[model samples]
Target: MFSRQIIPAVAAIGCVLCAALSGVAASAQTSETPYWASISVSKVYMRVGPSMNYPIEWVYQREGLPVKVLRVNEGWRYVEDPDGMRGWMAARMLARTRAAIVIGEGAAEIKGEGNASAPLRWRVEPGVVGELGECTDSWCEFSVGGHHGFIEAERLWGDGEP
Candidate 1:
């Protein structure tokens, strides 16, 4: 009689434990973060503390580099730069400028600089985000869409730029 009763009790405890575990798992999944966001302004500064009075330690410049937002506290946020530099800054310096990456490594080729024979184009360093532009195989032009020259597709980020 004791064995029979204990078996059901053990099974009941197992079921309760499984249900508790599942609930915890669900909560964890729902609490994820949108920490990584694209910089939309020409340049935003990451400060040392959390205000303007603080020194500017780094910047997420170039209008489109992706930044990892560590956390938002008070009116400021702690962020990590692409180069792994971390700092805090007031929230007003950020804007809606669109940014993108060169994808792989090295510089992208900028074409049409000279006669079409420059078909090989020229290369631009990666990690720089510029406005998207027209491109052909091995050639693309970029600027901040206007600031710089027509860097090659291999070095830009856009519909075909990348």
Candidate 2:
């Protein structure tokens, strides 16, 4: 009779241990905020607060646009765009894929290499969004449309450490 009672207790403890281990694995996959992310869908609404009940503040139609995630609460993320606009968006609307937007007063020249003296591959205007590849301190590999080239790191908002 004592052995039967101990068996149930042991099984209960084993189930709790398994649950705790899985929780740790899930939390490990969660990223810290103030990292870079991009719009994953063609349309996403930025709300005044972290919930759907909050008023819509902005409606973004551009996919792949980079946003700096400043905070995470529940399933929402507080983010800031390249233009310095800040708001809360659903976490599912954003992707972990790296991207960047051209910034500054005029078009930025995309060169064949990371050097200014390298051959020119294209010219991208401010606000153009593209996938970001490997980056050094001064330059990053960028691709948009079907064009791929190296661009000065300073010209992009989503460059540098995440």
Candidate 3:
């Protein structure tokens, strides 16, 4: 009788463990939408819908350009570019790597340090995209091509948490 009771209890415990493990695996496959992502390809098309049968809304030629992912379905991501243009793109063409674009008018000065008092390193114009680095309350480190410097956090579209 003890052996019979122990067998059922062990089987029940095993079923519960399997259920919990499957739940964890399911959660790991998905992420919260509306996150920041960057274009991973040199050229990718933004479609009007989630599938290729949809009309092409735009063709992005730049890689590493930051976009805001508004939603995800199947293998497509609904994204908004720095220009505020929203469309759907293939999820494979986007990466989770952080990137930022210089926004606002004219040119933004990239300083050697995170403070204004630091020497100027570069003057990046609006629309210039680069990899994003650590950020403080007021400034963030930015890199374009081979140059790296700090710029005001407010000047970048992808600076803070998404």
Candidate 4:
């Protein structure tokens, strides 16, 4: 009968819609991975596992610190810090903005330009997080609080040129 054919066609359409929606959902989840993101809050806890039930492995106090996202779970992301420390942090605690942190023991010199011999603009201590800008082979322009200048690319934790 026509009714039977109509019922099956409607069921088929419903199935196709479900599949398309599920595919969209999966891609949405996966697209966030393997990207650079920064800490959104002033303090965030890095847990041993993806959930709060896990023990706190570390506490990051610096906002705008950049992290490399390795994977994503339900409302959590596995990230690696500049020190090569890896742990899970809440997904909502991170933002898509680019940032960088100064590494090494000494204060990193910020030059007026990318060239090493350029005029010295200022200095920033290690572990300071700042907004990251364009980077060349060996230097990157960064700004923190009210200061902006270029620093050696090797001293930062964000994306660096080869």
TM-score leader: 2
| Decoy 1 TM-score against native | 0.44
Can you write out model 4's per-residue Cα lDDT over 2-63, one digit (the tens) per residue?
A: 99999999999999999999998777668545889999999999999999999999999988
- Which wins on lDDT, candidate 2 or candidate 4? 2
Considering TM-score, which of the candidate structures 1 and 3 is the better prediction for this target? Answer: 3
Clashing pairs in 4: none
| Per-candidate count of clashing residue pairs (backbone under 3 Å) | 14, 0, 0, 0
Question: What would the per-residue lDDT of candidate 1 be over residues 41-116, giving only the tens digit for each residue?
Answer: 6778888897888998876555566555676665676766556678885555543233445656765555556224
Estimate candidate 3's RMSD in Å.
4.5
Residue 59 C-alpha lDDT in model 2: 99
Compare candidates 2 and 3 on TM-score and give the better one. Answer: 2
Q: Which stretches of candidate 3 lie over 4 Å from their true place?
A: 1-29
> Over the full model, what C-alpha lDDT does candidate 1 score relative to the true structure?
0.59
Model 2, 162: alpha-carbon shift in Å? Answer: 4.7
Off by over 4 Å in 1: 1-34, 59-61, 95-98, 108-124, 130-162
